[model samples]
Target: MSFRPVKPLALRTGVRWKIAVAIAAVGALIAVTLSVVVHNAARISMLDNAREVQMERLLFAQRMYETSKPKEPRFGTKINDPALPAQLDQLMRDRRRGTFVQEHRNGGPPDVWAAVPLANGDVLSLHIPFADRSTAIMNDLDRALVIGSVSVVFGGCALGVLIGGQLSRRLRKAAAAAGRVAQGNTDVRVRDAIGGVVRDETDELARAVDALTDALNERIEAERRVTADIAHELRTPVTGLLTAAELLPPGRPTELVRDRAQAMRTLVEDVLEVARLDSASERAELQEIALGEFVERRVRALDPDVVVRVVHDSWVNTDPRRLERILGNLLANAAKHGKPPVEVTVEGRVVRVRDHGPGFPEALLKEGPSRFRTGTSDRAGQGHGLGLTIAAGQARVLGARLTFRNVASAAAPGGVGGAIAVLWLPDHAPTNTGSFPMLRLSN
Candidate 1:
């Protein structure tokens, strides 16, 4: 059998996906912001440490220069002390730019020099390896940047996945409940686990879905009771009509009255069958019966002139009363509108009823069954179009397949005329034969 795709639900806004995406986006933003702050703070702390080292080197150089300088300006400083030469050599290597020093022991280049003069007429100098200090600071900043970014990104992704999974699970439960509701299960509902940690919008949505399902089920129950009651009430008038027709005299007028009254009774029966089929509490009695025997019995009851051919003794499980009603309607339709000889055939579990008439109307053959379509011509004595509908409903309740099509036979007056209705019985029907033979007609 071919399957039809389900329609998209109009009520589902996909709020779960939206919520998960929002959480992921916010997490990404926070991770990025935290990374930036950490990187700047690490760089600033490294720079401050480098500056402090430079200041210490500068102070040491200035103190050395002050002690080496002459006390009086008139007698300028000449030969330097022995210790001065050693200190100057070390100071020259220091290369502290902010401090300065002058005069070497041998007129050679001054052991240490300053870019600018000091306040005490002394040039102070020191070396703290400023280039190496700057490079170390930069390396520390780079490490901080890399580590901070990786930690934030990984942590954020983990959190997002955990949250999304939890939310999706809850939403899926709610979705399943909604599907049950759509399939006519109004009592289905969903509830959330109680915990402050897990409490969120998904829980709220599940509660809302459950509430809606309960309300819908109540409405459906009310409508079903009303329909069943109405159908019950109608049977009385239909029974009266049948009884009144029976009291009339045996003549042409009596025949016409009986036929019309029977039609009304059939209509009332169809209404009740439809109500029963639609009710949620309705069920079918499944039992195995010989397909050939069943078809022969219905054909014999309908008309002796009609021919029936049984090709197989296959058995099928079905509600016998409903099965009888379905075949009764099909045979009645053929007898009422069909030309002289109708044929009932059974092959395996399939029963086919064909009539040698003018064939089904073109419009109905193409459109199939509708709400109130009687396939016969609109004569005053013909049916009111509920025969096929009731038969179809009965077939559904028994889980059987019923199809209508024009019979292709050249011997018929119309060449290809009338309807050939096929009903396929349950595949496992032959196994359950010990059950009751008469299935109840009412729910």
Candidate 2:
């Protein structure tokens, strides 16, 4: 009844976020560097211009004193009586200077002070306060640089996010296509399905996945053909052998021959069925059936001693024949390979069969059911390993999922982990629109 929430593709982390952050960082560095260079150059140019204007006024004031000989002469348009600082006046009086310019605080405010001697030996001095015109120009430049740098940083970050989203969406699409292919849906051709117009690395990756899935589909098809042919070819001979064994006299040798012949026939049939399932040739006949009663009947028919527990009562639409085959194989596997007290629990749409055995092999859990991976544990040359393979195949055809895991056996003294085979079926018939959740990993 409950399903885990699937995680969505992320733009805040992984390759997307990394790419965005890297690009933004480089842009921000460039912006800061340019702002610093431009700010310094503008400050130097403004201050230099201010110093030149101050010097021109000082020269004009000296000319005014020589021509008019006024008591107090206004130097230039912006200059009042050019007052000399004490240091510059002393330098002029000592005759230790010609036309000169210097920058100092000089007990007042920071300014650029210039002194020029008059024809009448009067030293007219000029001072440009550092905080007046030049400081205002520098402050305006500072604000503009700050704003420009911030704009560049924000613009770069936004562009990075946009580009990151585009790239991440492409990659996520390809990844999702590959996931479906891995889950046995080999029809996924990523390049053809979601390939972009402009070719890039993402397109290259999608093409690679397309090639891989195509190759796998061809190989699987070839294998399926071989399996089906061999199974069909063996069916007749195996039937003849069985008939011949039955014609023989009643004895141990005759019984052994008949039993082996029957097993070979069953193996051939299972192989053919698997081939059919692989080729998508099998179809399910769905009907609403009582879940509790149907499972109890199947469990009793297979092994009366096996325990059956019905936790929920519900009707499900599924093929009864295929369902029986799946349940039968699971019960047979537990009987042959697992310890005693096999238990079947039907909860919701899931039927779990637990056996008190040494559990499934690690390889089996990692790699689902394979062809002939039967291990020699308790019995020598007992199981052919096709039971789970066939069960899993049938489960797939029925729009169900079959999973096997190992469960703890704490109550059983001296007992180890036990094997648990789970068969999950959809509650209703699959729609033509899309697929239902087929499988879930057991916790």
Candidate 3:
């Protein structure tokens, strides 16, 4: 309804992949941590069991030799054995039982040994190579753990991708709907999250946006209808009033009456034009025109006192009538509310109209001009505020950009600064490099 352009942010669609990577990292960390812990725990348990077995074998051998029994003592068991591990032999010197381990070379399994003191001041020791024998089983367990860790990581990554894809899809759909709404497409309704079955935040967002668009559309329609109705109702009566004022006897009072009536009539016409623009039924009758000549003629016809300076002229395609209306409104506003020496400058495709008066109000600059939002009288009379509004709407109809701003002070006495209204013609230049007849060469 405002006819302002909408610029949407660049939506990032990589969140799904980011989610997948994050989940995979977490899963891998957990899986690898558990794998290492479990493998270490199993290895320690097996080594402990071997140590216990060696200690029991040493005791059994010493007992069998004492009793002179028949069965050979727990295989590798001997008394005061020269091949006993030095660490275990020294550990048992105080007539106490102890266990010790010995390392093997080149990543092979270590040996487990235990020793005990006999009654004759001799040490009985035994050793078991269970670690070496269990090497194959340990390797198999390591492989299994590694495979399981990999499986968990891959599974987590896939699951993350699935979940992120769904969320991204939902969010993207909502974002697109919002973009369309911003572009004045009131028909784009997000059906999935509307009604009464909202399931997530995205649904809530969709519902809120849908409700807002409905409200805005209804408000715009109501405004347009009211404007059109008021303008139509007042048109015939204002015309009759103007006719009646002109028939009055020639006097100062009569002159005042005619001026007021004419002003009211102008206001009614402007209101009607605004209503037409709002209805979006107006189409531009585009034609090729000489830019400098067209603007100079309009300015002269509107206000002979205003200055026109054409830096470079170019033939452009646009609606001449709409462009006239736009320029007329701008010149009228400047003449009525601005200082003398108002000037119009045409620089290639741009037209600037500036006046040496106090700059536009801060509110006008920030929020743009609106109907009936006249400024305070201290800066002179701010009219119905429909002049710029109409001009902007006409510019839009002609596919042009209209902007307002405060430039530097004009070279005039008692001048701080003034408002500058700029009109930039749309340039749909030819695709080919060669120039055409209407195209102006740029320096």
Global local distance difference test of model 3: 0.80
- Give the local distance difference test score of model 2: 0.78
Best by lDDT: 3
What is candidate 3's CA lDDT for residue 245?
93
Off by over 4 Å in 2: 1-12, 61-110, 113-126, 195-198, 375-381, 409-416, 430-443
Q: How do the predictions measure up, each by TM-score?
A: 0.56, 0.80, 0.68
Query: Across residues 1-443, which tens digit of lDDT does each residue of candidate 2 receive?
Result: 99999999875566667777887898889989998999878866766766676677777766666677554656432222345556666777786433333455464435667676565676666665665666667778889888888888778878888888788888888888888888887877787666667678888888888887788789999998998998999999999998999999999999899999999988898888888888876777776798778999988988999999999978888888889999999888888888888999998789999988777877788998887778545422366788899899888877888988887667744455688999999765443233443546699
lDDT of 1 by residue, 1-443 (tens): 99999988786545445555566567667767876787668656654565555456555544554575543221222222233334454554464233223444664332232222356444443333335555566667678766766666566656666776676776677677677666555556566332235677866877887787777667866775786688689789878978988998899999998988887777777766666666634557676688799878877886777789998878777778888888888888787767657888899988898887777776666665554666545311366677777787777667677888887878866577566889887663221232334546796
| CA lDDT scores, all candidates in order | 0.65, 0.78, 0.80
Clashing residue pairs in all predictions, respectively, total 14, 0, 0
Q: How many backbone clashes does candidate 1 have?
A: 14
Better of 2 and 3 by lDDT: 3
* Runs in model 1 lying further than 4 Å from the true structure: 1-24, 65-117, 120-141, 144-148, 192-211, 242-260, 290-315, 324-443
Count: clashes, candidate 2: 0
Better of 1 and 2 by lDDT: 2
User: How would you order the candidates by TM-score, starting with the best?
Assistant: 2, 3, 1
